[model samples]
Target: MKRALEKLGCAPVLEAADGIAAQEVLCRHADVALVLTDITMPRMDGLELLRWGREAVPGAVWIVLSGVETFDSAVAAIRLGAFDFLPKSPHSEELAVAVRNALERRQLLAERERLYLELQRKVHELEQTSEALRRDLQRAEVIQRALLPHSPPPMEGYCIQAVYRPGQHVGGDLYDVVRLGERHLAFYLADATGHGVTSAMLSVLFKQRLVLVDATSGLPLSPAAVLDAVNRSICEAHAAPGLFLTAVFGLLDTSNASLTVASAGHPPVLHLRAGRETRLVRRTGPALGLAHDAQYHEEHLQIAAGDRILLYTDGLVPSGTERDLHRLQQVLAEQRSSVQDILAQLHDAAQGAERDDVTVLLLDAHAGASWFDNGAEGRAAAASRAPRTEQDVVFYGEADEAAWLALRGRATWMQSDVFHETGQAVLAAQRPLVLDLSACEFMDSTCLGTVHELVARGGVTLVGVAPGVHALFEELSMGDVLATVRRDAPAAPELYAIGAGSSQAAVQQRILQAHEALSSLSTRNREEFRDVVESLRGDQQAGGGHG
Candidate 1:
């Protein structure tokens, strides 16, 4: 048997006296491809051997040989998973052919097992790689959101709203609405050449280098000068080649209601007035970083009260048509709601099919004098227009020494005027302010800004806060900005310290709190608030302040 097996290319053919010994032989050789055994043996027979081999070495093939050619024994051997069966005393040619067929079948099974294992290993590696990429994208999204403004500047008679949606986890669209002073309002919108991590990084660097005011004189820079400085910064940097930026820089003067804008290869800014008329301010020069010395020109418009301006990136409208501006303006004019409501309408109209980063900034000019100069009159006007129910009136009268203010309905831009007045009054009185917000169903950016401003003055606690309002504060990470006690909770003891001693230290603490809030807001907020805090500190140092 061994000699015949060797002739069929079975090198070093192994032999055993019985089935038990043959099982030991197979155990010693893991690479054994085929097995040939007789049906009847000493202790363990071929049928038992076949059953054990079928369970232990599933990828190997087996063939049986028996001199007792009984139909029952042959059927049992075949059922025990033998590849082929033949008589024990057979021709050498037949034995060689059977061994060849068994070896070929074994080789195919081994190859299939190897391929399946390799596939499983590769799938595991891909899952690990995908998990790592997902974490990276989440970190990038957090960084991008941190770069945006926390809340609009607390300026009077000018309402600003912004919406940003990146096509990926992070994108290249950026916008800022900052107040340079009491009279000058500055805003800028920029879009890089592409989206995702590369473009998002470029936008962050651009935001850091784009100077809004002269460092030495503290004067607001011109729209053209701002763009020129940004252009030079982009051109001189070590950015990727073929990358460029399109932007519109604008300044609004509250004194004359004039707006001066400078554009660099960006789409035109949309101007919509109360009468439903639309106008477009076209681009003045090529995109930034494309040229070493790109000169930009400025366009001036005599903006009226109630005039609306829309500044956006290219993704807000289609690239092919100029009439998209008109359509957008018509949509804007049709909505008489707040800025956030208008943005919701526009977002739904798009059906979230934005392929690039979309950024939109809407500014509405309110017809009123600055709250800094006419706080009492503004308070009266706001109070007259505010719709009050019996519950609101009762909530307002809950004050002993603390000033109680109840907010009702949606706290949107329309409520901002009253909020500013209420904030100023509470600050000037130097009393504890207890705010009742249980009746307020919603809040917008302007209302949130007002809340921040009021809390910055110290000695403020919120009572009767609804769950939605509480969750909003938590979402913005401003839960610790002020104390909020639910209606069921016991009243806080600090609410009774309106005209108490240690008022001087409390005022100083409030100033410190304001500084902390400013630090938490954004980089621009920290920079702008620096001067205000310093001025207040300077007055205190000179003994001309209440503290």
Candidate 2:
């Protein structure tokens, strides 16, 4: 058998006397690939050796041979994991075939085991790499969060609040409210184009370059000029296609409640008047990094008592639709509690909808207080001040007939309930109600929503709508009601005051009803105001009103 295996080029074939001797050879030569054994050998049989060899030298293949082979012996040898079973004294050609087959089987098994070990090593390496990446991301997330403001700066006669929620461990939304000088406050909200490490790095660059003062002149830049500078910096630093950011910057003159705001492809700044209609300070320039010389425009307006300016990233409203903006406006108008509560509500809404990185900054002007003094004495004096008796609405006719209601000065939520009560009474009595806005300088969201409710019903007319008031209507997408507007109306007479005093419950109900009326105008309005309406309903039930 050894001579025949050698002829088949099986080199250095070692001979064993019996199964026990074969075991000794296999134990010594751990690299042995093939074993030929006689089933009936002394000390230990081929089957026993085959079983022991399988456990000791698992890679070796076995071939059993016997001159007087019994069917049972051949079966035992084959069942013991022998590669081949052949009779003793067979032809050299037959033996060569068996040895060749056994060696080939051993080679295949060794190669398979080698590949498996290699695969296991690769899997371990991948797991380590994945864990390293996870740790890096966690560290990045902490750094990014640290860059955000912990709280807004304290300002006299004003309340500032902010909320930032990143969609991922790292996000691209950033906001800051910094005091530019003794009398000026600068606030901004910026959003990079995407969400990830790259976008986050770009947002960091934006923060670093958001210079409020001119480097050369050492003078504070205007809101528009600041945006222009930011845009130029980004355009120069990052010329990559599809990379950009939207931002809104505002500079406030703390002394006179004047606000100058500019936007670069960002969401409109929400101007929420306490108890009045909300207005949008629209965007005025292209997105930053889009053009090297993009010019931005600024809008200047005087902030009033109980007024708030809301700046947010697009992540707050992922859809970026007219309806979505209206919804946010409605939320601001409805949530007249504290700035913190408003931010919480907005953040919850954004999170519930699974939005991207969301950031909201609110600036509120305190009512009836001096910007220079927000001390306890000032607050006590403000609390002790008499309620305003200046009539904002004057009725000229009876409720049973055509009634003329002249809205004087700024018709806001403080007086919206009075007008709302009179308008409803007149409308309910099947009488004609005419609203005179010729003397009205401004009408807030509450009053506008009240007017919307009255107009939605029949027998209402609006005359002498001022350009600003007309623009408000257009912005709310209530242009259809503008069809009832006339160039002029007859002079009103016998004016009677619609008093603006009401219980807390009545005021809450009025605000709720006004927003409900606005919500009924369109499907989008309904969706946007749905939560506000439900919340109002709960508040009304709980005897709770805006703080």
Using lDDT as the measure, the top candidate is: 2
- Give the TM-score of each candidate: 0.63, 0.62
Clash pairs of candidate 2? 275-413, 276-445, 276-446, 277-444, 277-445, 277-446
Name model 2 segments beyond 4 Å from true.
66-70, 73-80, 87-101, 337-355, 367-547
Most accurate candidate by TM-score: 1
Candidate 2 lDDT for residue 269: 93
Displacement of the residue 119 alpha carbon in candidate 2, Å: 2.2
Q: Candidate 1 — which residues are off by over 4 angstroms?
A: 40-43, 66-81, 85-98, 239-242, 352-355, 367-547
CA displacement after TM-score superposition, residue 200 of candidate 2 (Å): 1.3
Whole-model lDDT values for every prediction: 0.70, 0.75
Q: On residues 348-374, what C-alpha lDDT tens digit does candidate 1 reach at each position?
A: 466455467777777778733221110
- The whole-model C-alpha lDDT of candidate 1 against the native structure comes to 0.70
